[model samples]
Target: MKQGTIHNKDRFLNKVADRLNRKRITEEVQLPTWSKQPQYEVFDGLSQDELLDQFVLQCDAIHTNVIVTEADKLNDDFDKVIQDMGGGSIVHWDDPRFESFGLDSALKKQQEQGTDVHCWNYQLGEANIKKAEQANIGITFSDMTLTESGTVVLFSDKGKGRSVSLLPQRYVAIIPKSTLVPRMTQAAEKIHEIAKEQGRMPSCINFISGPSNSADIELRLVVGVHGPVQATYIVVDDK
Candidate 1:
């Protein structure tokens, strides 16, 4: 064995051996039980109605626009959002949920009417990234909406790429009432459960509260500094 390699191995082994008998280290470490409900009573007695109300209030506080629409009339509402923003190119996640909601068909119809629509597919490779970057609007589905923080959680999957939310000038999320959770703790627990069931977590899990803003430059509070300047959340009352 080379003298340098042997010395490195001995140093590593000595470091490990020194830590084994350290009296200052405690073996019984207690970590916060993230899966359990927090002891704080802020959300304890809140009803579903109260939660939704709080959610809207918090969203407004964070400069996020919330639109409530009936589940059946989502298509119309979606079209209204697009029209209000004017006809332009849109990029969206290619999830089955979007397909089931006929969003794909609606986009295709818009495309035939002279608007550009791009569905993100990994097969398209880097082209999808470019399309998302240049799109006027990007739409995605929220995995969970935390009522307390008015946060939307997005987990990247095969059909849902992170760029669909991060790359556009305007980002839109279609959230179902059923996906609403109480707070961040519950949301984390749900993500842990998903990981256990799937045997792995997604590569990226984004928690988005509102439009991106930063006060770093002269503390002037610039919006869309690094991300979409405008974000809209459409909550479908599927109940």
Candidate 2:
């Protein structure tokens, strides 16, 4: 123990902490008042429909396409988003959404409706790797994360993999607003905690704050050198 340490400090400290943790403190701690918002604001207190509108406006500011709608509207929004992005036909798919959500019927219908949203569904063993590779635009929900800088961390288990965020020309992510926080660093710390508890490292830990970009060219900047040229984040209000 350190010089200032007490022998029974763990239990005592916990008891003190419990006493200090009142309902008001908990509520205020979760949703803090920002001193000010930047010209580009981080959203709060918006409904799902409102959030969708806000998300779309921000996307337009950066020339990124926005798509929203649960599995029910996936076919429409999914196809519309791709077409707006200037992509032709669904040349491929990553298939993560289908197995996790069984969105095959919806996805297949879009394919038939000239979405060109491809899905072989050949049952080529127990892997969905190839489907994601040829996809024009991959869609999935994020595991709840940052609001500032528009970052979303899609844990590989439930949502799309890190590759889907990178390999495609454009990427779209759906974030439930209830999970939003102020910035990127907070998301990192939370992921670290989840990582420690799991006793195994996540296969991929992407800290995406915006579109894929680089300025390492010949004295000029460029985007999507190694990944998507553009990125879009859709925040949905579940409350």
Which candidate tops TM-score? 1
User: Model 2, stretches more than 4 Å misplaced?
Assistant: 1-76, 87-105, 114-133
lDDT of 1 by residue, 1-239 (tens): 12232458766766777889643443578887667545445577777667878889999977888888886788888988888766589999988888777677678788899988988898888999999999989999898999988899999877789998898899899988788778887888888998888777887999998888798878888778888888889988767
How high is the lDDT of residue 226 in model 2? 74
Badly placed stretches (over 4 Å) of model 1 are: 1-40
Q: Model 1, poorest ten-residue lDDT window?
A: 1-10
What would the per-residue lDDT of candidate 2 be over residues 101-194, giving only the tens digit for each residue?
4456656676676665644343542234454566666565666555444556666532334555656567767665666655555567778888
Residue pairs with backbone overlap in model 2: 90-116, 93-131, 93-132, 94-131, 94-132
Model 1, TM vs. native: 0.84
lDDT of 1 at 182: 82
Q: Count of backbone clashes for each model? A: 0, 5
